[model samples]
Target chain A: MESKPISLMILDIVSILLLAVSTYLALVFAPLEAAMGAVQRVFYFHVATAWVGMLGFIAAGITGIVYLATKDLKWDIIEVAAVEISLVFFLITIVLGSIWARPVWNTWWTWDPRLTTAAIIELYYLAYFMLRQGIEEPGRRANFGAVYALLGAPTIPLTFMAIRLFRTIHPVVVGSESAEAQGGFNMTADMRTAFFFALFAFTVIFIDLLWNRIRLGNLQQKLEQLKLNILE
Target chain B: MSAQREKDQKPSAGFLNSVLAVARKDLAAELRSPELLLAMLVFALLAIFIFNFALDLEPALRSRVTSGVLWTTFAFSGTLGLNRSMAVEKENGCLDGLLLAPVDRAAIYFGKAISNLLFLLLLEVVVIPVYSLLYGINLFNPGLLLVVLLGSVGYIAVGTLLSGMAVQARTRDVLLPILQFPIILPMLIASIKASDGFLTGVGLEDAVPWIILLIIYDVIFLAIALMVFDYVVEE
Candidate 1:
């Protein structure tokens, strides 16, 4: 395998540094939420991770469409990288949301639409991997993966809307105070700064990880092709 | 120009005929064997029985739980029917023969989907009465029946498309539900809600949105499956 590029090395360093800064901003710079106390602090990272997850999901969907149109294996690699990153980020978002919900909602979990949709989206991602694993031929595997990703992509928005329409106790912090009854709070300037910065930091980390993953996928493909050639 | 127009019109007409031809093939084959419907009905009965024992299904509880229990039975057995429907095509090499026929691929999709819908409806026809007889809840209401039909259309639309893809994979049987369940969650939610409304005699205004959502899901997925069926079945 080729060594990591110098630019990626720089990005790796920058991502770690920004993560540290964002953690400090979240942990110290933001005021302790009056209503929920320390547990509320998890919201910064929670929303940030969810933001990255959404970004990765959209990327996967677009790449899936492009792969279908162009029939290129490269787009498939990028789609998988995007999905893998989103899967990890969404996991963090769900766990953090659950932790923050415990003290505030007086329950470990709520059937809030957002949480439920997140859980469902996680299942879609898992099923994506399982579908890919079951296909032995690389080209067919990529084709099936892209098609499945495309079909599965719309569920995220529809799920969000369905849950929103059904009934939602999840806090809609960024918008109007609709969820005030459900422990939604207004963000002060400091909290906003931390919140937005966490979003920025996570976006950077997401790009950094996505680049590394794509490179990894390329390497794996190359290794497979090499093995085939040697056997022939 | 006249000859070209005739050629174009011929294929469009052929598409519908081809779709029906495929559906008829599946229906005739299934009638001869009768195994798919038999399995689905038995499985639906078992699922209802399990729910009966598990939920205690008292008279008061039966009304509230009927929609959920019925939809769950349909969803589980629906997968069985879908997997079997596609697996039969694969096992008998019918898929390759269908593909080699000079028909629009979407015709094959519609054909399989319609046959799958018929099998599921057949299972529901048998299961619903059994459920009612055992629980003593009259489930013959017109509105509830409409809800069941709409819900099954949405389920079979997506289930047919996904099962077409799943049956091509190595882990064919196990992959369908995993690929299907999360995507079909909205349909299940809407179906259960709409069925509950109809069974409880709620106002049409109250149930309209869920019914509308079900219709929208059915249309959207049917369009998507038609457009993408070519990619999935292509060599």
Candidate 2:
């Protein structure tokens, strides 16, 4: 069996330390918002997590194209890792957005374009997984998955546009302030520090998680190959 | 109409003939059986009843949400038709036969999509009248009809490709909606909102944006289906 790579080990340690520092910066170092109170702190993590979700989104698109062009299974494994990670991060982004919205928007949910698109994106990820799972052959599975990923890539923008149009055409029923997302404040220096640090920290964490996931996928593929050999 | 004339066409003309031939094959098959259309109609009519009772759609609420109720029926029954349409081809070994033909795979896609669209439109032609009669809501507006045409086009475009892929999977019957609903939500949203605008006499200006959205969605997905159908149906 191959040992874990030293570079990955270093990344894992760095991610943990960065996360600890990031959380401290967000929770304590950042001054409280004058408007929405303490719940505003969730924005730091919320945006960061959303950023990671976008990474997954972009990764899924590139891997899909790369797989289709190259017809390689390796890209499919990487696609799955990117999707799984994006799925979890998107869920976190939604929950955190909801938490912030509860106090700020005075409701648990708002059909804001960005958040609604994120929700739809989560559905796309699950559908991708389900589509992959229903097929047994890796080659065909990857083909179908790659096709869906490519077809779905443009829909993120389309969904946002459609939903935003809907909001404009029909009144939100939830009054103007919440409806228009007019409830945010300009960040001071302290908040800016926390914000940038959170983004920086989460990027490292996302990279570390993606690397580990790709390693596991490769290992799983190897195991499947070994089982086939043993049976033969 | 003869084989000689069809063979005498240009490349693009041959492509059209191939598309029409495949479409004609499907239409002829459906005409012979008629079960797919009948089932979709019955399912859609039943959905109207369910939505009516479920919403207790009073005159006031009826006018407001009739577009939603109508599209909801179409969306559900549309999925039914899409699933059955592909599944029938797969089940009868007709899909393999189609693939073996000397034609572009995208022609196959357009052919399937066209037949599917016809069934959906025919279903709507009946259901809308029946629904309006049942609820006393006037639904014969031209704008709404235009919305229906574009909406079903958008639906069938991607739905055909997705169902083509779904029908090959082990859990194909259930896999399609899971795969389809989210992707088509934007299209549905556009369609429903546009229909609502027209139905309520909100004027052309109100519905144009949504109509544009539908057109954009249909064009993009049509192009996508053309590009990706080969992969979905590849052996």
In TM-score terms, which candidate is top? 1
lDDT of 2 at A89: 98
Clashing pairs in 1: none
Candidate 1 C-alpha lDDT tens digits along B96-142: 99887767777889999988998999888898899889999899988
lDDT of 2 by residue, A1-232 (tens): 8999999999999999999999999999999988778888898898899899999889988999899879889999888899999999999999998887776677787677877898899999889999998999889999999999888787888999998874532123123434444565778888989999999999999999999999999999999999999999
DockQ versus reference, model 1: 0.73
Output the number of the lDDT-best candidate. 1
Per-prediction DockQ, in order? 0.73, 0.76
- Backbone clashes in model 2: 0
Docking class of 2: medium
Specify the CAPRI tier of model 1.
medium
lDDT of 1 by residue, A16-117 (tens): 999999999999999999988999899999999999999999999999989988999999999999999999999999999889888889887878788888
The CA root-mean-square deviation of candidate 1, after full C-alpha superposition on the true structure, stands at: 2.6
